[model samples]
Target: MAGQACLFCEIVKGERSAHVVMDAPDAVAFLDARPLFKGHTLLVPRDHYETLTDLPGEFLGPFFEHAQRLAGAMESVLGAAGSFVAMNNRVSQSVPHLHVHVVPRNRKDGLRGFFWPRQKYESDEEAADYAARLSGGLT
Candidate 1:
């Protein structure tokens, strides 16, 4: 279940806003606001599950299925050479909501290590496009 005020919960209910990339009765995908790569995306269950252990077995199957589809789509659409999927739990997670990050990787991107430095946004327009392009793939 989701609380009415949770940011992700609002996105699930079609309230607030997000550039959603994929949606189903049980899961939804959207671009990560703070991305490590150009097309980084997040896939989350519509219901609130704080950790992997909290999720029912049935939900896990479809969630990963959708993640795979979205990862493939990102590779093709974003011209990414590879991708990484990760989920953080209580110790590492900043948000309690359960979600997975699907990040696109490219050989030429010049990322020296797993922890690449983040860049600052110069304009709102760029952010808006990032959201829209990711959301477009949801369909």
Candidate 2:
């Protein structure tokens, strides 16, 4: 990733605060500080891997297992019609560490192509509420 100062690594290590939605031994899911939607979540591996190819073969299954749960939570918990799940290996990856974006989706959500209009929670309390709901759905 971005050496020892990786942002996602900081979140994984609890050095930075994030509205965490799912915490497991291998991965951590959290609400996007700048969300694409209210319930948008980012799922990252606890370990720092710069890109998808950097991830160990053994880690692939466990990493995506958490993603599956998050995608489901977008619908099961947030009442979204469906979900949009994606990852960028290097080109469009904002953070150096690998992560997948799990965004709630509806038929007329107005998300066209790769251009996403970002959104924000009304407040931290609202963000936390979303985190709590998605977090519970994973269990």
- Candidate 2: tens digits of C-alpha lDDT, residues 45-121: 88888888989999999899899989999999999999999999889888988999999999989899988899989
Runs in model 1 deviating more than 4 A are 1-4, 108-114, 119-139
**Taking the candidates one at a time, how many backbone clashes does each contain?**
2, 0
lDDT of 2 at 71: 91
Pairs with steric clashes in candidate 1: 21-138, 22-138
**lDDT per residue (tens digit) for residues 1-139 in model 1:** 4333567777888986766777789998877777787667788899988889999998878889888877787776676788888898887776677889898887877677566655533555666676566556543
- Model 2 RMSD in Å is 1.2
**Over 4 Å off in model 2, which ranges?**
1-4
What's the residue-level lDDT of 36 in candidate 1?
81
| TM-score for predicted model 2 compared with the true structure | 0.96
Query: Model 1 reaches what TM-score against the true structure?
Result: 0.82
As a whole number from 0 to 100, the lDDT of residue 86 in candidate 2 is 92
Best model per TM-score: 2
